[model samples]
Target: MTSFQQLLTDLGNKSLSVLDRNIPKSAYVPLDLSVTNAALKEVDVSSASKLGEYINRHIAMNEGKVAYGGYLEKRGIYNRSDYFNQQNPETERNIHLGLDLWIAAETPIYAPLEGEVHSFQNNTNFGDYGPTIILKHIINTVEFYTLYGHLSLASIENLQIGDVFRKGEQIATLGDASINGDYAPHLHFQIIKDIQQYSGDYPGVASQKDVVFYQENCPDPNLLLRL
Candidate 1:
């Protein structure tokens, strides 16, 4: 029911801290997610060479063949297809929808601003977001959604929808590999305008075919975090 302009105003007026800004230096470092130092890597996969490499890596990992590619997959294999059908355990297609901030386990996650808890769910599964939480915030008269995924199990145990929490409050802890979908623990933060009838967990990554759908439904969390 809130207007978008008013939402922006509320966010501006609210005292919010950027996710990486003011946090301890340790929080920014990679915790448990496999990481690579590829500064020259292109952010987008437009070349055949780049796209081919991405697919090969994905196929290798899904087949249980250990390779350096798994490290990238652990962090997140960029711009890869979200479909799977030939695995030992049947899998469904669901691309990630947000930028995953990979880091070590047990990092403290704080609320970006004061808001009410909108929803929470334990989405435990391989290749699935685990222990996700969505917060409904009103900024400048606009209503938006902030989703935190790969969270520690304790984070959602006591929370309820509509429970008010203060800015910078300790809302959740980062989940580690054992429970965070077998990847390094990190916060998967996303900004959503409409949940589209989905609750508990939303896509954190999407395929090129889904770019437009994701772009409108899920805005960049950086709009609020600026990180």
Candidate 2:
């Protein structure tokens, strides 16, 4: 693990809540939406409704309220969008750079740590993050950022840059397919050691050739969430 990752792990001994605190950690179940999940071949994952149905079933079967996974995972879900792949296999941004927490739309998302808003925007590209928020956090004299994507439009409507949010504070609500890049309702949570010149947006997916750099810049969010 990277030193930053170890720092996140050492931040706490228990899981952090990104969703409503009422939901226990046990309510979260791991999900695999990677290219190797053969079960996807039988389903039309391109359709938001269809893919959502599959995910909902998985959650129900697992007796979980929320489904979360997909850090550095090679996903096929990006195949439908040219924004992610432009007919170039090697350049396709099919590797997810964040951890996705799948849940119902309008579900409240909380701040896992105290932070101030760095930026927020509504990315309109197909398969993009849609309404997104980036929070800057400094702990132990180290500076970093946390990104919350696929958020409801209202989440950014009245948000201001540098707005302070305490740990466990409600930062935003999950957006539905119509506004959240046409995907199932989920929060694309990511951590960045270095955001470069990005603002209100960052690549939540990376090409295989760029995976190494992205993997380092955007460490596993699980290092903090622990779920």
In order, candidate lDDTs are 0.58, 0.93
Least accurate stretch of 10 residues (summed lDDT) in model 1? 64-73
Over 4 Å off, model 1: 1-15, 18-21, 24-96
Tell me the tens digit of each residue's lDDT in model 1 across 49-168.
443344344435445211111211223333132332223221322344555564446777777877888889988756467798888887656677778888888888888888887888
| Candidate 2 residue spans exceeding 4 A from truth | none
Candidate 2 per-residue lDDT, tens place, 26-135, comes to 99999999999999998798999999999999999999999999999999999999999867878989999999999999999999999999999999999999999999
- What TM-score would each prediction reach against the true structure? 0.65, 0.98
